[model samples]
Target: MTLIVDQSTINIQVLFMVNKETKKALIEKGAEIIYLKGFNNTGINEILEAASVPKGSFYYYFKNKEDFGIQLIDHFLVRFLSGADRRLSVTKSSYIERLRVFFDDFLEFFKGNGFKGGCPIANFSLEMSDLNENIRKRLDTAFDQMNNKIALFLEGAVKNGELPEDLDTGLVSNFILNSWEGALLRIKLTRDVYPMKLFYNFVFQDLLNFN
Candidate 1:
């Protein structure tokens, strides 16, 4: 098969791909640093340096740091929801087991990291919500997106008798997210797994009450 290649089309394709790769690189590098440091403590130049990107071209990809932060939240939301969907969708598993698998993944992650770098969204919320409205709003929506996903799963569990029929999925999911984020904060502060384990225990045994 003879391939007819247009030079202009090829150039556009290459440029678009490069742009996407560069943007993803920046977000990934930035997320790495911001996870350890914070939104206020982290600088764009630092992210650029980590990404091995030139100084001037950041504006080419993002309008500003706020733009970058918003993009980061958006990127995180997509990745998080994807993982949640996977962890919460095992066909043969009980709904409770599916949720336990989800938390266990994070439990292992924080333990491996020595209990540092808690939830990225919670970190951003603590640092940026009072400071930047755009970023705050983006973070707000991200939390809601997360809650909605968990609630959707919980709603299914309620319908299937895995949870009580009277259970409020929305409220329960909101509480679970809040408590889990708080647990992450505690573990990060104390550098201990006790709080994380505590959350896992109470959530499953007391609140959800699943056998």
Candidate 2:
């Protein structure tokens, strides 16, 4: 005999599923707004209005604004890391080519967005790190993770003779990440992509000198 499910129960389950998606959509939208405008500049009302989510629904998903900010950072990190992992894992590309692909993707994104907003980590670190210890620690961990991942890629390059055997992978990774951050800041200040392009060119040429 087949077991029959209650229609009312099914309706309740459907509503629950929809509510979960709605909550995720709200958080994603809220994160985007915060990334663009910054945490301090993005008021709760604006996020709620932008997400078309009521205050009650926001509270249902988040304990407070700080909690929401943490989740937002986590969400952004997942997306960013996933893309980086995909680019770095491509088998057909040389290690150096993979690195170039990574940087080129970032450059295209910056150019596409008109460099209106900079890296989300950099933006959040500047805005909330001073005021929030938890957020500061999270941002710090994210940066460390990014640096480590790049360093691992560099280590692979060295292993494959793509880079100098004696090259300091850790330092090189830090330099690249730090330089990119600085380039992004310059882009924001100058309202131009020339600085970013120059940065990429300098980095590419410098890496070629590794042999």
Whole-model Cα lDDT of every candidate shown, in order: 0.89, 0.84
Candidate 2 on 1-211: residue-level lDDT in tens? 9999999999999999988887788778888888788898888778888888876677877888888888888887887677789887897877877887887787788788877788888889999999999999999999888888778778878888888988899898999889888999899888888888777788777764465
* Candidate 2 TM-score to native: 0.90
**TM-score (all chains, Cα) for each model:** 0.95, 0.90
The clash count of every prediction, one per candidate, is: 0, 0
lDDT of 1 by residue, 1-211 (tens): 9999999999999999999999999999999999899877999899999999999889999998899999998877887799889977787887777888888888888899999998898889999999999998889889999999888778878877899887888999999999999999999889998887888889898999854
Runs with alpha carbons beyond 4 Å of true place in candidate 2? 4-16
Q: Best lDDT goes to which candidate?
A: 1
Best by TM-score: 1
Q: What TM-score does candidate 1 reach? A: 0.95
Query: Against the true structure, candidate 2 has what lDDT?
Result: 0.84
lDDT of 1: 0.89
